[model samples]
Target: MASSPLGHPTRGTTGTNRLRRNDRWIAASAAFRTAADPLVIDLGFGASGVTAFELATRLTKVRADAEVIGFELDPARVATAQAQLDDVRAGRTNFSPDLRVSFAHGGFEVPLPAGRRPAAIRAMNVLRQYDEADVPDAWASMAARLSPGGMLFEGTCDEIGRIASWVDVSSAGEPERFTLSLRLAELERPGIIAERLPKALIHRNVPGERIHDLLTALDREWERAAPLSTFGATQRFLAAVTALKRLGWPVIGGRSRWRLGELTVPWDSVAPR
Candidate 1:
């Protein structure tokens, strides 16, 4: 595997199930269901491989042959995660056999053992350290390693995974959708997702931009849906998404997804104006 010239290490703060929302999204994704080679990459999976292992466990439900590989720029981080995998495989840990996870040291090129392209590449909280201007190159680098019909999910989230927003990019390198997943009960406003927007939309959240307008509209709908709060936070969130859709916004997904505090909008809806 080749190393990156622009390697920026992270603080490496990670916990068990820290990326559960993302895992859920991927497990329900069409990419996983239609993938011929069921190989997924957990790019920059911090100092531990638990998140990748957890994703593998969930993915297996969608595709029994699914496997996850954790990629890191830091070779030491890969080594540490590998040791943990060894312990789990030796019956010293509670991890299941279905969680067939491995670790590799590589950059955006995503060097796999058999020169395989991945069905999905998830790069979360990995590019926050770089300037927003560096996003395109990074996206291009990872997208190039995807299988023909593959997808790339890149985003940022709070430490505990309560709020998250990500962009799904196709193997052609065009971003397809922008999705926000939150914890609705205590959500101050739907605009909270602005803080977790992916690189493509993060800097573009300023006034006059489509992303800014989308957030503003979301906050307004959330307020309008306050009546549903009596039913429950989930109900209130569903109402907000319903409102947005009725208002002619290109909201994707149905009530089933909205019930989980998730709302997906077409990329064109919030793309930079």
Candidate 2:
């Protein structure tokens, strides 16, 4: 058996539905549609596998044959997650037929007994503990574990399901897009996402940087779209993202996604300066 390379063990703070935003993003992703083996890795799934289980439930709608593998560095956490999954298997917990979730003790190496790489990997709130400079290496290591034409979603979110941001990385170990998903009710300004930006762009939220300009543009557009608040948070968000695009912000995705309080931008539009 090969040892995992992700040396440091995380704090293992697990919670329910904490990764809803990312899960939804994966469920709607094209990667799931064309995957030969629709397997997903819930990298660093913390102390419990509830988030992994939820991810399976959500993705099943897109790919009924999908499977979710939750990985943790701590042996104890892996044991706990496995126990929870077993309970679900034995009909101990309420689970859908398509929710095939499992647990494994692996670090950044993404240990697979059959040397099978996954179609998608979600590592949320995992790298925030490491130094900013370590991000690129970690991204490369994890991205290398992806199947051909696969995706790597690395990001952070608030404790609850609200504010979140992530980068969509390709199999080439390069980021293609930056995404921000937020709960828009009473939003002061879209720039608030700077605090939760992934390690790559978090520190680059300053003048002259692409991320800084992107945030500034978002805030400005958000203010202009305040009138859409009369319709609801969803309408306001749609209007704001649209405004950003009109101002050459390179915003991607459409109203259907923006309706969920989510927006994606090309990597070059917000990459570190």
Candidate 3:
């Protein structure tokens, strides 16, 4: 482990439900659901600890023992989150007073007490500012701290949480899957996720790249499913994802996940070519 946190401080930008989509996805993950530890890390949770609180609230529904720790490299941010945690404890906030949440000063090293490892680590929007070349090391540093069969969800999303995408890295630091999520109700095109892709794929979304091809195909299918929008955006998204799979895009998951405006594929399907 690094002597100090191995990353820079984030912009400290965050809001209520800004990570709702991610929270939902993590809650459904087998890593979190099946982990004996049930401990999740909200790496770089920004200026507020609300995301960590919200994550705990959601994950506890799946497993009451679920706990979350908001991590930041900035000491001030950790203090701020601790203050919020205090508020929650005082019953001044709407959050459960007993919310199993905490704040810590750390970065990609994912510091934990007593050599504890996390079931899953959520690094949403953390690496966007770093160079793409820095992604592998960052992924490795964090993934190294995962428990057996754990995962590292590293990705980006709009501040409003409307559009999101992430790479699911295994405990070995290998990228296993990539996921793209959108707010389908008024989504113009699925390709818009290009702006919020994880650092690994953000720059690779171009001509002849697999990511470019995936986005191009997704846009086409989304347009083709435009008629289904009359039934609702969820229906339209489901149709598009189904069509994408039929077209041999290596799409993963089923209608159940697609209905949330999410489409997943093997990391290789969109890996930089």
Q: What is the lDDT of candidate 2?
A: 0.86
lDDT of each: 0.87, 0.86, 0.93
Per-residue C-alpha lDDT of model 3 across residues 179-253, encoded as one tens digit per residue: 998888888898999899999999998899999999999999989988988898888888888888888888888
Better of 2 and 3 by TM-score: 3
The sequence of per-residue lDDT tens digits that candidate 2 reaches over residues 1-273 is: 345457487786877888999999999887776899999999999988899999999998888899999988888898988888778877888776347788888877898878898999999999988889999889998999899999999999888868899999998899999999998787778788988999888889989998898888888888888888889877877888888888777778788888888889889888777
Give per-model TM-scores. Answer: 0.96, 0.96, 0.98
Worst 10 residues of 1 by lDDT: 1-10
TM-score winner: 3
Model 3's alpha-carbon lDDT is 0.93
Off by over 4 Å in 1: 1-6
Worst 10-residue lDDT window for candidate 2 reads 1-10
